[model samples]
Target: MSTVIRKYEPYNRFKGYLVENNIKQREVAEVVGLSVSQLNQKLNGTRGDFSATEIRLICKAYNISPLDYFFYD
Candidate 1:
């Protein structure tokens, strides 16, 4: 079987990050200043996108660099 090399998908990576960190969606929603329902919409691609400030806030909340965690593939 050929191995599948997946290209980076931002939302998918974010979801994986939540899982890997054992974090609740509500917790992340709080970090990003979004309501749980709003976060769900964004994560599911129904909403537009996360603002830069929101992303920065989330990275800061987790004590991570946005460039390292988010901007990278």
Candidate 2:
């Protein structure tokens, strides 16, 4: 039996989206309906996971798709 290992791709678009939108972290928090500290935790990689509802809220707030955040080239 062979164990297949895949490289882990972190969810990194939260910051990118903020940058592209010219939004500050505080501003992103407001737009995404999250607390500043919570958003910071996510951006700083302290939070290990984002709920599906959180993902949807972010996508809806930013007018993007979940695929846009999670997919890689």
> What's the CA error at residue 3 for candidate 1, in Å?
28
Lowest lDDT 10-mer window, candidate 1? 3-12
lDDT (tens digit, per residue) of candidate 1 on 1-73 = 9863333333767777788999899999988778999887776656766789888888888886666556654
lDDT of 2 at 47: 63
lDDT by residue (1-73, candidate 2, tens digit) is 9863423434567577777779787876786678899777766656645678777777777788778775557
Q: What TM-score would every model get versus the actual structure?
A: 0.72, 0.65
Q: What is the TM-score of candidate 1? A: 0.72
The model with the greatest TM-score is: 1
lDDT of each: 0.75, 0.69
Clashing pairs in 1: none
Q: Give the range of the ten consecutive residues with the poorest summed lDDT in model 2.
A: 3-12
**After best superposition, candidate 1 residue 52: deviation in angstroms?**
0.6
